[model samples]
Target: MEKIAIIGSGNVAWHLCKGLQNEHIEISGVYSKTFANSQAFAREFGLEVYQDLEMLNKAEVDLVLVAVNDDQTARLIEQIAAHHKVAYTSGSVNLKDIDHPQVGVFYPLQSFTKGKKVNLFEVPFFIEAKNMELGEQLFDLAWKLSRKVEYADSNTRSELHLAAVFANNFTNHMYSLSKELLENSKGKFEHLLPLIFNAVDKLKNSAPEDIQTGPARRNDEQIIAQHLDKLEGDKKEIYKIISSSIQKKYHEKL
Candidate 1:
């Protein structure tokens, strides 16, 4: 029964608390520089929020999970590591640079939004530790919350984070753009839900490059030009770049 204390109240911290508590981990307490945030979160979790970091220092915690911003992670971890085993939830930061032997990474590889319902059991947790002992402790904790726990070094975790930005952030922005385009044309974007869902379902069975379609994949110059002509500004630029890339890829196949 290793007790855990979470620092920060951002999306990652919120979701991590949810998942960890469900797995019966004692989120013994919470800490935040913003007093209101810590108070609110503590109320929700029915745990007291320590107003002073000194108070947190006095508590017994087997692990301190820091979910602060990337720039602040190292500083927070360093401070907490003096008396506690600390892990920062950051994908891009290298653990090697942190000189503490009790410091590690406990990054949850998923996009999170505050107040959104997230199924963390399906989300991957990437764990890294300063040594084998802390590594096992972190890995075992992650495994309790998720079926997709795995070990990833700093370099690999950073690359995976980059890939996630492309796959999730950029792709979601494209969807938002599509919705705006449909609204401008007097159409509801919900009509595209079936198409979007089907495409996602198809990818579960086939690689995207193998299942490529559309005028760009067919190298239909006329249709591509028409589509480009219909778009303008950043939209047109994005369309041209993606269309050209698709055409170049499949053309090499021929």
Candidate 2:
């Protein structure tokens, strides 16, 4: 098994390490700038922790997975350029900015949290590389980690990142808003949990347009107007915009 070193101790790094471990790949060590984070992660994974780049470079590893944040990715790549085949776990960063010839992207398109177990096989991995050979290597790595692996160029990957912001992050914000509204009404937010789960479940079998429902889908103008009246503050404006968008989409489908 090829040895892997991860250069961050955040959610993405943690999850990636767990996935790689499940595949029985050897994790040589983990490098984090913060000693506490590095120590904690190292203890959990039973791997050495390096707080310095020099220490990490000394470790026996074939690949270095950089899971640092967007702003720090380029700097980290430069710091580790000469040591090993460096790959980042970012969907937004351009691979050209990194100096390493073997640099690539091994972006897993899923929200990760520390202590949460994520099944990598269910998550889509978007692989990219500077050359065809490196691209194939990245794809093979992705395939080992996920059942759904796709080869995407930089532009396509960036576009997917934008779409993810809208589909996942923005939608999550909307869920929080829903919870807030329900709480304000002295209603249990848990009531909507099943509906939320079912909405996502429906997406697996049907297109979003085909599964859409509520007043907009039925063209019930009266209920729409009533909903608009019931909504208050910024929420009312947001409701109007979303309803308008839904209405426009519904009309386009006609």
Candidate 3:
């Protein structure tokens, strides 16, 4: 595609625009439900800003990237699919659910935060299209943005999205809880930074199952009891559930 128009000026759009610009791909303009955001993003990128969906639908672009929220994505793609080649960036949105022939998925399997630049070269791009021709086109386009590109259908993409929630969202929540506990005990969260880094670094060489530690993994009842006694409410409940799961998984190995 020679020129592409992007919908939504959120975190995904912010990073995508940068990645496309780096590859010298011409982004026709950007459109958003919020006019101020569209103006700001367009001004930042030196591109045209479309005031409404109707205006964007008539734009001279080969592809339109729907980088909006998952709930709004299908509706937006449905509106513009007839005019331009459409691809969305949602991992959970089923391709078949959208009744469009030219629709596809260009899901980036990474969490994006505005102003926090990530290495798009390493982020995985999952492509799914209605037909082989559109699929191949998206694959080629994704390859330009990242080294890791794979053709995954809606089901596989949905599974990957679930895994990502556990790996990234749940893990980050754990870190947040750890920080809260440390603060309550008058301990510095920074002191645990090295330990956290070491735990993650070890996973690079060994599977999580093989590298399991802690009282729960070791099946040390006394230590587990002691730890559990220190926690209360939802934290205590979470600890109980996760510890039980870990103990069960490592039961044979222990």
The model with the greater TM-score, 1 or 2, is 1
Candidate 3 TM-score to native: 0.96
Clashes of 1: 0
Estimate the TM-score of every prediction: 0.94, 0.91, 0.96
Judged by lDDT against the true structure, how good is candidate 2? 0.87
Model 1 pairs whose backbones collide: none
Error of 2 at 179 (Å): 0.8
Off by over 4 Å in 2: 252-254
- Model 3 error, position 73 (Å): 1.2
lDDT of 1 at 63: 85
**Candidate 3 Cα lDDT to native:** 0.92
Using lDDT as the measure, what is the rank order of every candidate, best first? Answer: 3, 1, 2
Candidate 2 vs. true structure, TM-score: 0.91
RMSD, candidate 1, Å: 1.5
How much is the lDDT of residue 9 in candidate 3?
94
For model 3, the stretches where C-alpha displacement exceeds 4 angstroms are 252-254
lDDT of 2 by residue, 1-254 (tens): 28888889999999999989989988988888898999999999999887799887777778888999988998888877474787898989988877776788999999999888788889999988777776788788888989999988788889999999999999998998888788768678898899999999998889888988988778788999999988898788888898889988887668
Model 3 C-alpha lDDT per residue in residues 8-45, reported as the tens digit of each score: 99999999999999999999999999999999999999
